[model samples]
Target chain A: MHADPKGVLTGVHFLDGDHACCEGTLAAGARFSAGYPITPSTEVVERFAWRIPTVGGIFIQMEDELAASIAIQGAVWGGAKAFTVTSGPGFSLMMEHIGYAAMTETPCVFVNVQRGGPSTGLPTLPAQADMMQARWGSHGDYAIIALCPNSPQECFDLTIQGFNLSEEFRVPVMMMLDECVGHMTEKVVIPEADQIEVTPRRYTKLPPEEFHLFEPREDLVPDMVKAGDGYRFHVTGLTHDERGYPSMNVETQDVQVRRLQDKLKPLANGRALCETENLDDAEVVVVSYGITSRVAQRAIQLARAQGIRAGKFRLISAWPFPEQRISDLAGRVKAFVVPEINLGQMVHEVARAAAGRAAVIPVSHAGGSVHNPDAILKAIVEAAR
Target chain B: MNQVTLEIPYEIPVDAHNPVEPFLRMDRMPHIWCPGCGIGTTVNCFTRALLDSKANLDKVAVVSGIGCTGRVAGYANLDSFHTTHGRALPFATGLKLANPELQVVVYSGDGDLFAIGGNHFIHAARRNMDLKVICVNNLTYAMTGGQTAPTTPDHVISATSPYGVFEPSFNLVALAEAAGASYVARWTTYHVKQLSRSMEEVLSKKGFCFIEVLSPCPTLYQRRNKMGDGLDAMKFYKQVSKIRHGAPTSECALTKSGEIVVGKFVDRDRPDYLELLRGQMTESLGDRYAEPEVSCSC
Candidate 1:
């Protein structure tokens, strides 16, 4: 479906990542947002609050992160595309509702502008520590899509993709941006509304009598219906049957929980968003994402200048981890040099995907700042040897 | 109050049709509510209120949190949501704001609404959000096996208060009024007629409307306190209840075995959240501001 022109700002402009994300939210046709202010991520909603009033939407500053997170789901069921934004502390507070969204298959977006963490760490500094949490923080055996944007332009681009993937899979999509990207100013080009493709919500065509709220279609996603639509659908956070009624049996749990993970297998395979370069002839690969990925690009160039064949693998979709692509590269590459702001998070995923076929070297930083390019270059040169 | 053009019938017809059945998910019958629990009785009153108010059933959405009373949303055959514990108000706030046409109702337990969800309740009421909140106050957390709740009366015995509760309980009606609810009322299961009337009144109102229904948790709250059963609790309500139509809520706190004050304490005018938002936006933006369209084009 074409983007709603009423929401799309069709022009090129200089903007920060936070402000560009707000434009992406509008372009994606989200008409309702509820949020609480948190550092590094506050500007996203700040811009949203200023812009939505003119774009014909509502932005309610809720009581807290817990309320902000679930309120968006309520708006989603009311038939509006909705989202919430937060940083580390607020993101931790929103974990339960993220689980609730996954359980009930509510489509929404959660934008986390990452900051140094473990409770009120450097609130103004960048970190990729939340990459692991975005995949597993909501205490459950469920899968979610997390996208990492490296720049202000990609922040604008991936946020729309985040909403589309959320609607397509009926799961909450996390737009993971670090403090550097969120605060850094850059130029962003926004195309016309017709050029921007949006995925419309899949509402069921079946009559009220025939429709089951949680009955999965062939694609394993149930069509949705909004409130006041006379469908009289019931949706709950508990383990439920296809009819959307709570059934606390082992059998029901097996069917419901397995589908939440298995349905996203396609995302793990072909639809994975990754940028690869020089891998066909390279001996060493530098795997990275978010702001750290930009720094790793410099490291890859430095390694090649020293007569070592090093390649760049920039992860755009961080979760569902692009396992197959990494495993494919693992057989051919001699080593993988993983650089991230965190001590060692996604490095483990890279190691697991490599599966003893190649060496895995971690270039870790304890966060508050992005990694130095020389630090990653040192690891790449050692792995190449 | 948003006036209902339909006239209030002088005598409500006692039809052969079961009023509650059509409003219930009969397939999900044999509900999880314990026998002798008064939560079911409140649901009965709610369904009758829907019938009396001539509400568009399709437009009414029920949202509940986690508790014995929270199960009402699951049984309700409206477009319902069984949400996380203590967060129903915020959820309902989203539903009501996203689609102003929806008559969003938040039905849950005292522990869910008054304890963990206390902040959301106060903020939502302070905003005068257009939501009808019905709290089934069973005095304790019956779903979690009769733990001491924020509404447990002083000197009452509970699982967490084995020695006896020293803490005070909330006067929900007073809290509702103090938090800026446009309408606030208190009733008990024994006052079935009045409870249904209050529900009907709140349904017709536009701002934040609160009705606290003091109910019996026969297997837990009552039994733990040595109050015989649900019938005995109902008789006790009949004996000690005082019908104070406009009494000050400050003087209406409940005791373990004292006079139970039941009444509609506040009925006042205030602009709801959406009204203030739209009014302010339209004034500033003028022709540039367009009220949000219903998200579903269908």
Candidate 2:
């Protein structure tokens, strides 16, 4: 389904990553947003608050990140596509309700423009340190979809994809952009509304009496019933049955929690969005995502000039790990060199997927800035040996 | 002990006039409330208000944070959301703003609303978000076994405050009034008729409306204090309660074993958060602003 044409800003323009993210959400049929101001991520909501009015959406600046996170879920339940944004500290605060959204199967998006962390490390600079936190910050065994955008252009493209994935899977999708990409200005080409396909909310077709909130279809995703629709359905953060009532038991817990994790498996398996180049006859593959991909590209070129056949594997969707593709390449290549803004985060996943089939080299950066090309080039050279 | 009753074709006839079943998830009964708990009385009054208001029940969405009273959302036979601890107000705000057509009601206990969620409560009221917030101020965290709450009266013994509460409690009436709530009221669970009437009044209000029902937690709060059962608490409310409509919120603070000031305190006209949003957008953006979509997608 296409987005509501009125919300789609159909012209190409020079925009920063933050502005592109706002336009992308509008083009994805998002009519509601709740947020708190945090550096790097603040520009996303700032642009949203100013521009949402013209397109007939509401942007609420909530009291804190906790409220902001849960507020987006409320909007989703109330029949509008919605999102929230934060940096690391605020993202830490939002962890509880992110799990709530997962348990309730509330389709929404979160934009976390990462900065140096553990604690408010570098607000003005970039880091991918929160990559692991984004996957497991919320204390539960639940899965979420996260996308990594390499530039302003990908920021626009992937944010729209984030909303589509959230709605399709009924999960809180994260668009993990770092401060560098969020503040970086570049040209973004936005297609007309006709070309932008958005997955609208899947409202239930059953009548109110027969509609079951947690009853899944063959794909394991249940249909939704929004508030004020005469479908007096109940939704909760507790272990619940198909009737949407709380049912506490080992059996119920297993069923409810397992579904939350398993519902996305089929969607995640063959659906890792990435850009690959020069893998055929390559001795080493450099795995990177987000801003690190740009830096890694330079390292690949440098390695090629030195007569090493180094391939590029750039991740667009960072979560669900893209394990199958990585594992296949692990046997084909002698080693995989992973670079990220963080100190050995996504590289661990890469190492796990390689499963000792290939030697995994992690070029860890302590995070305040991007990796130096020479450091990555040295790893590329050493890995090929 | 149960074999005789089970062997008998034992089924008591249902009360045909139990008007509350339609408003509650009857299949989930008998409820978790203690036999003499005042929470039931409060729920009864709320159910009465819902019945009398004649509002579109489908358009109403009830939300609650975690606690004994938070379970009210689960029991409510409306579009209900049972959310995390201390977050009902902001969650309800999202519902109201996303679809202005929803009659969003936040029902939770004092600990959930005033302790962990205190920031949200003050801000939601400050924004005057259009919501009907019915808070059951049982004075302690009853669900957690009589722990001291933000509304726990000074000198009251609780599981957390065995030496007696040294910190003074919040005057919720004054808090709500000062925070810019458009409507504020207080009553005990004993005041069923008046509580129900206040709820009806709040349902039609256009901004944040708070009703504090000083309910008795017979199992936890009452038993810990040796304050007799629910009946004694009702009798105490009848004896010490002073009906003072339009009283200043400051004068309505509850004292330990003192006069309970109860009445409708503040009612006024004001633009809700969403209303102000639309008006400001229209004034600045003029013809370019598209109104937010509010219909529920069925």
Fnat values, candidates in order: 0.76, 0.73
Model 2: per-residue lDDT, tens digit, B128-157? Answer: 999999999989998889999989998888
Per-residue C-alpha lDDT of model 1 across residues A79-173, encoded as one tens digit per residue: 98999999999999999999999999999999999999889998999898998899999987999999999999999999999999999999999
Docking class of 1: medium
At residue A95, candidate 2 shows an lDDT of 94
Which residue runs of candidate 2 sit more than 4 Å off their true CA positions? B1-15, B294-298
Give me the overall lDDT of model 2.
Answer: 0.90
TM-score versus the correct structure, for each prediction:
0.97, 0.97
* lDDT over C-alpha atoms for residue A358 of model 2: 96
Error of 1 at B128 (Å): 0.3
lDDT tens readout by residue for model 2, A1-385:
7767877777778999998998888888888899999998998889989888887778999999999999888888888889999998999999999899999999999999999988878988999998888899899799999999988988888999999999888999989999999999999998888898888778888999889999998889999878988988899998899899999898989988999988888655588888999999789999999999999999999999999999999988888778889999998899999998877999999989999999999998988899999999999999987
Q: Give per-residue CA lDDT, model 1, range B190-221, as digits (tens).
A: 99999999999999998999999999888988
Q: List ranges where model 1 is wrong by over 4 Å.
A: B1-16
